[model samples]
Target: MAAIERYEQWMARLLLFNKPYGVLSQFTDRGSPTARPTLSDFVPVKGVYPAGRLDRDSEGLLLLCDDGRLQARISDPRFKMPKTYLVQVEGDPGEENLEPLRKGVRLKDGMTLPAEATRIEDPGLWLRDPPIRERKSIPDNWLKITIREGRNRQVRRMTAAIGFPTLRLVRWSIGDWTVAGIAPGEFKEISV
Candidate 1:
């Protein structure tokens, strides 16, 4: 029975965490002068690490797992797992403005692969803490952007490259798993 329990513990485990804004994706704050909220604040499960990084400011679905192979499959750009984001940008953009994103924008790193970009109605997600800054003069627009590669701050950079700066960014899904039904700072575990 003890051996069976141990075997079960070693079995692949996955967690879908609804990462909130301003929270770091890592488990610890490391050497930061000021302590910042991290996964440890929300997820108490041991041995699990984030499969891919979500920037401190970005909110939404963040995958954590105990298996290294599973982590690599999710995080590795080579796997080309599609990551989709619901982005609110500063200005209302027409299809022409989003064309650059669909065709792949050239960044300082290199040309990105073409992505699926579309203007979307507000997804009406939960209100973010502290809220996004609002400008009465400029209208904001929502976009559903899906990309296969996980680049550092890629979505924000992509929108900016096309003349619309993202005001708020929420990662809605990573492949089949999504942030749906999970509230901020909460996580659901699953066995793989």
Candidate 2:
């Protein structure tokens, strides 16, 4: 492809990343004594940046865009775009235990917006390189959760507050986009 062709192509699309565990969502490395892997490591595409963040510990679908307006639309809570997650909790939290989360669980920061919570079967998503530890005696359960707001460690805090600590958290979808076809450390750009 021509240089201008490639530039235009790179500038006008959405890049979906299935961010692996331990990778920073940003393009630049900030302040770790050891060099942590970043989105830049996998996505060499220029101009586009992550629209939202997925903590270094969390994994799954992360969106990137060169268009600032589209980035705002995806990341702003006021837009009420849905972000869904498949969360594994430390214990078997019955449906009733999740009622508080659905009703907006209060946290140190404040009450979260009411969200969608449902006990679900294992999503059969990709395995983490370093898997979550298993305690044979303690049971674990999965949940399909969708929240509109993005807070720091929000999913983990919500589950912990309700007495079921989070084990593994994977963002399954954002708005209509999903990590359904992407694999860890890989990414693809799609037309808006």
Top candidate on lDDT is 1
lDDT of each: 0.95, 0.92
What would the per-residue lDDT of candidate 2 be over residues 1-192, giving only the tens digit for each residue?
Answer: 699887776555789999999999998887878898998899989988889899989999999988888999999888989999999999999879999999999999999999899999988888897999999999998998999999999999999999999999999999999999899999988977
Clashing pairs in 1: none
For each of the candidates, give the backbone clash count.
0, 0
TM-score of 1: 0.95
Instruction: Give the per-residue lDDT digits (tens) of candidate 1, residues 14-80.
Output: 9999999999999899899999999999999998999999999999999999899999999999999
lDDT of 2 at 117: 98
Please give the lDDT score at residue 45 for candidate 1: 95
Cα RMSD, each candidate? 1.7, 2.9
Error of 1 at 39 (Å): 0.7
